[model samples]
Target: MARPAAKARVPKHLVALAVVAILGLVLVADYLWASSSASSSAVWSSRLNLHTGPAGSTPPVAKKIKEDKKSVGSTGINATFADLPAPELKWEEMAEAPVARLDGAAIQIKNLLYVFAGYGTINHVHSHVDIYNFSDNTWGGRFDMPEDMAHSHLGMVTDGRFIYVVTGQYGPQCRGPTTRNFVLDTETKEWRGMPPLPVPRYAPATQLWRGRLHVMGGSKEDRHEPALEHWSLAVKDGKALEKEWRSEKPIPRGGPHRACVVANDKLLVIGGQEGDFMAKPGSPIFKCVRRSEVVYSNVYMLDDGTTWKELPPMPKPDSHIEFAWVNVNNSLVIAGGTTDKHPITKKMVLVGEVFRFNLGTLEWSVIGRLPFRIKTTLVGYWDGWLYFTSGQRDKGPKDPSPKKVKWVALGTVCHCHRCVVCLFF
Candidate 1:
């Protein structure tokens, strides 16, 4: 009789509570599933829209992400100061560039470093000149470049007050360079036309040597064949004294993207490539077409501005280092650039090692390395620190992934206020 006693009736309120708990669990599970799917499908923009200025300053406008539709490559990895080849050196981060760009030019005038025209994207070019004040470690005013100025592949140099910008790709990617050249007066912030190049070149070796603007050895208009052509213009006070560029002795090795500098009153051309990336002839958009290129370690120096003497070569072949050098203790300190191609992948490999070519010894040595492998880095030196910014960073060794970066990296080369010991190379 006791076993047969009716099963205890479950409490109605308890049954109702159990049903509600089950419903809640199902809803939460559904929400999590939907969120997971959405996150997996989202795509990230390539360019970062950062607020750039003195640290802690409020942004004038709301931040926005710029998605490069044409940037359809792998999102590469990042590198830091810890990755530098020199263990004794330390890197300090500085103000972000006013605009992220590559293949631009940077020149120091007094305590200010002026960064001008370059490619914002393959199809987007920037015409703004941003000034960074090293005196205060702040990004100061920005001005507009000449509207018609070429944006990328520019050959730029400064003579105390005037900055000369020479021939380069005028518009979007792979477009032919303009014959037009320009000069900007830092004091006036005004740009005026200079004598155009006789043959439009891409990233020619340009430097102010002995009161003449010497330009030599850049890719021809087609952006394929190297031009051995050499030309010079007498320039003074932000103006070209001559109507046209005078012809000079041609370079022995013709190429683009070379670092041209004046060291010990000698005009030196170092590290460049024979060919460059061209545009696909028939593509609707100006799509970049990679062609065969030869990276060389050849070092040519013009001792008397006429005869170019062959000097000791770089430790490795390098290119795209047009502005990646600074004079440190009478030595030429060169930074990251594109070097030889990967044997297996056949893609261009990037160089991270910092090289020093001693003018006194005529020797080459590796002093340090960049945070990462990069090309087209604009460089400057102030107060015993080597500062570089704005370039295309590669993924890693043998990985040629194109990673857009806006990092302002500074490495201490000598005794630092931070009390770091100098590791002389």
Candidate 2:
């Protein structure tokens, strides 16, 4: 009887309230613990500064990037090649060109390298054509282009069998442009006439895509008039000698000395000088004329042939005028051209930097610097090597003397698992 009396009845509502209060207290404690733990974890992470490398690779606890002393160009942009993955490039001296020339075009067909018309040592344009045989490593089989077809700044392209030479200047001294177009059969070594361009131009970029020849921006008849028009020509039959040129949509902006190449099935127009070069007034030297030209860092891409869309600008704002560009493994590799922004003085100098743009990532990085600054050089990609023909080195205004070059620099592209290694001497 005494034990039963001790059990006093509790209210149901009070019991329910007690249970709710306990649950609320438990949640509050959990929230506070979580907040404090998260804050401490973040603080520790910041202080630790952990870095993770590629899977299965050990990452350094700390990294110190060394500054590169070499300057990029007159642009004053400096970059270090230490952090960048090395490109697959090996450079060596090949056989010297049979002749030294500038402002010309070169194309590789099979094992033969065709060097077209260009200005020689005396600054006189020559119609000389020289073929270099890779099999024998010799330059021979010289041919004279027709008097009419002999021109510089011509847009030349090859379809693996025939070389198509398009619009160009008639002479070396900034003469009027020529509309004449010709095709040379590599098999027969015979030249034949093709349909002339709708608009005559010089230094236009020509490339073969989808069995059609695409001719892009260049200067008009007058060196001052930039050709904004674009045209394409197709040979109905592979063996046909005659073809019709059709005009496509024009480029939004025109530029002379633009470099064009097809990479990843996209037609890319690289940097070029926009404005016309004019003589500077009150200059002491004859060639001391100041250029009104604006160097472009813009890049445009044409995928449909009817529309051109601008892509990311170059890393630097220097013009690629008279530069050499090649498509290596779907990446755009540009090298050797003057900034061309300033006059021929200490400020005006050739760009010794080499830039490579990855089409997949749309990123550009300075790969390496040229052994010597060069401009208006001929660059050809054959097998796994990039061949740089003769080019002039600018000694600046004090000297204003053109340096002679005869050796052909061969850059052999070495393929690594995830990176390219470019070795140059």
TM-scores for all candidates: the values are: 0.75, 0.68
How would you encode candidate 2's per-residue C-alpha lDDT over 1-425 as one tens digit per residue?
Answer: 46555677899999999999999999888756643432121100001110221112111121222223343333222232111222222233445566666676778777677888776632366697888765545688998897898467788777778888887877644556778888888777788877888768768878878778888887766465667888888763233333667787888778777778788788888887765543234433212123456667788898987778999887655443443777765577777675544343324445555677888888887766543455666665444444466555543212222243222111111010001112221
Which pairs of residues collide in model 1? none
Give lDDT: candidate 2, residue 340.
47
**Which lDDT value does model 1 have at 183?**
90
Please name the candidate that would achieve the greatest lDDT relative to the true structure. 1
Off by over 4 Å in 1: 1-88, 397-401, 404-425
The lDDT per prediction is 0.71, 0.60
Listing every candidate in turn, what is its Cα RMSD in Å to the true structure after a full C-alpha superposition? 13.1, 23.9
Residue-level lDDT tens digits of model 1 in 74-181: 223232111223322323345555566677788888768888777766777778888877655678689888878888888989998999999888876788888899
Native-structure RMSD, model 1: 13.1
lDDT of 1 at 141: 86
